[model samples]
Target: MERGTRTPGAFAGALILALLLGGLFPALLASGAGGTPAALAVCVLVLVGARLGWLIGIGERRLMEFSFWTFTYVFLGLAALVQFQTATFSTSTPWFDTAYNDDAMWAVLIGSSAAMLGIRLAARGPTADAPARTPLVDERRIHHLAALGLLLNLYYLIRVGPGTVLLTREELWAAQVARWPGNGLTAFVVAVFTLPLLVVFIGLLGVNRQRTDRGEPPRYALLAVVGCVLLFSVNPISSPRYYSGTVILSMAAALGAYATPWRVRASASAFLAGLTLLFPLADAFRRQGGVETRFAPLQALTSGDFDAVIQISNSVDIIARNGIEWGWQLLGVPLFWVPRDRWSEKPAATGSYIAEQMGYPFTNISSPLIAEFLINGGWPLLIVGMFGFGWWVRRRDDRMVQIGLLGGKPSGMDWILPFYLIILLRGSLLSAALQFSVLWAASWFIRGRRSAGSEGAAVPGRTGAHGGSILTHQTSG
Candidate 1:
């Protein structure tokens, strides 16, 4: 297939790969690898290989990238489900249970359906304009921001480390045995999502790749690197592993938006949106099972109980469940409500232990925005902060749209929205909202200036305006 033609096929391929990489491979690897470190490495390789294969076969880089990220999020969800199922079936070692295989099958199928639907819609047309400048802030600014965020993250880590930190090295390693082979999967996801932007940025600078656009000046890549570093350093109380991926992915999207063309941006946006919608919807279906018993592996890994991991995973599951339920529940109260007792007990009972495994308050409440609001103020702050920031970013996006500096026809911000949403979904809505608002505001300012200039020039004798024509008066002689 040709380059552009490949986006749809790549989306389809990504959906299929997610199934094999997350669902099928996990079990197969478990059977063979015996939960050893080597097994984890092997599984990571398998996933990487699968992703590479999809990229090669499908013929679209953006589609391939989307697939990788979707796989990361979906795999994490699936792993949690697998752990939950193992709890009910048996407390046996290497807790891979068949109890929820049926559920697993359906989850895969449903997720695939949603992804396919999205891809089909996205595939129909070109994306918005691509950004010309990669979103880069000043180097000094980047360093300063990184330093501040790092300090906070370190302070938080110090405060919580003794009691609640989920150190992967210690947790995953055991006496000649290792658990949760999929942890490496998370690591691989982190590396894949984070590294590329740095490479692209560095290459753009006169350091690596030769500059093709000689007329274009080299912009600040350091700002982005620093911001990213700082954000990653912040010891978020949530699943840092998952959020780390989001951070890096967002960074990449920002970079991609700056560098890619408008049409490419549209394609990327359509592809990513389509891919991510799958699990949330499928998960809604999966949760319909009588009981959720997916925390066994986590309990076994952390040497905790089902209550701990369930608590943490429940928060995540609930985010999706709540949104979907609320979306549908707008019709009727009873329609959405599971029996009060059932609602209270099920997630709570299972989730309590899971929460502990999840490191609770840190991952759920102590994340960037969530933590900020709780520690400093409350939910209202969260709402206000988010809206304020979102409005600002939306404004800036207008600027990017006007200059055509941002790639493709879609706004530069559009391509980055998924990345933003991924990071903010479980985060403090306020902080995320604020940061994005700033971004959009910047874009808007540029757009506004350009528009004002253009309009002024359009008026007769508006020579005082920035781009007006000659002000010279004609001589009668």
Candidate 2:
């Protein structure tokens, strides 16, 4: 079998290796052999090995897996180790060596176990035995998405003032917040970030399809323009890191840079390094009136970027005092379509609520999925919720990998949502809710799911987009 061809991989063994290596990575980072038993650090490193290794070593190289593990390894793992030793955190009030660290570590362990259970169970299902479905792309629709994307981006550019789009990350973020309730930024997301992304992927799929299904060339000209515009819109300097990451990584996946096991592992390793080293420097462009106090990459991990660990600890503390919100806090994300004016009694986001309780001057802290699950209904929900997420990821991963291998084509959701998840995972859900709402709606609108017929791919030999097997094209799964 081709190494790129689908393989069940050594899932069971991989998980064991992930635990030992993942736990070991952070302990090494903490202090060679070290003190405090480093319980939390162990849990985090174990998480990195399980979550990160699950994707690179055993995963099918799906975009969703990359997005999921990237959070575990980069944003969560490095920061945890950094804090364990330095005993510093992002909060104004100190949150180090508190009573909650051990308990929170247990919570982390429980939640991850539940998630892994879901992934394992899903992999055993009957559907995992079925052949993957193929979807025919509507060339006409690709044209529509491209036009729509350009129109929306152009309108957003005008509304925000053309020059405003060129500001630094922090400055641009400040400008968007200033636009308030009536801001045109959502338009930017729907168009610049997602729509053109579809244009490029759909265009590539069309190129590969000509050999298998034997079709005409797609509008490569339009794809060229859209691709260039997407680059301009998502430049690192002006856009938010998460949003920029979504677009750029999705584009790369569409090109097949992340399809094979070796490629996925290589990219995953590089990604981990980048998050540890380069992610801190990202703030160089993010701070207003920059150059305040620069620290090395390791020290910077204790800053706001790594606060998901702190936020989880904070969530655990909140549950002890106020108890979970029952289910009220969970309602806001699904019902995000309802305007704030429409739902007067809507609950604040879990992050904001926790920050309020903690008396932080800023409410823009992260609340990871585990934190959300705990806040919603405590341990039961955390277990059940992660299990559900795992099940869903496995189901989707199997399907998307199949699509990559057999069809060489994918839907808008196939590559997009996974990257968006990076932000959602590092989230104040209410803050992220509207953006996802618009993003999902746009994806649904041009959903590349085949309208009819079973022929979804062309021959797999061409070196079309990012120089990978055309069969796995976008999925590189």
By lDDT, who's the top model here?
2
RMSD vs true structure, all candidates: 16.0, 6.5
lDDT for each residue of candidate 2 in 1-477, tens digit (9 for 90 to 100): 134444555555456547645755555666743233245566656665666665666645556666666676665555766776677777533443367766666666677678778877876664332123444455566557667677877766665566766777666656556654443344334344444554445454544464355554444566577777777767767777777777777777666666676677677667666667776676677766755456587778877778877777788888898888888888987875676677898887888888898878776677888889889899899989989987887778766766655544666567678777887888877667776765666555544554343432334544435554333322321
lDDT of each: 0.35, 0.65
After aligning candidate 2 to the native by TM-score, how far in Å is the CA of 356 from where it should be? 1.2
- The parts of candidate 1 lying over 4 Å away from their true place are 1-27, 30-53, 56-59, 63-85, 88-108, 125-418, 424-477
- TM-score of each prediction: 0.37, 0.83
lDDT of 1 at 38: 28
Candidate 2 ranges with C-alpha deviation above 4 Å: 1-24, 32-37, 91-97, 128-133, 177-212, 291-295, 448-477
lDDT of 1 by residue, 389-469 (tens): 434333333334433321222333444454555444333333244345444443332221121122222323325445754
Model 1 lowest lDDT segment of ten: 171-180
The C-alpha local distance difference test score for the whole of candidate 1 amounts to 0.35
Clashing residue pairs in candidate 2 (N, C-alpha, C atoms within 3 angstroms): 22-45, 22-46, 23-45, 23-46, 212-458, 259-476
- Count backbone overlaps in model 1: 65
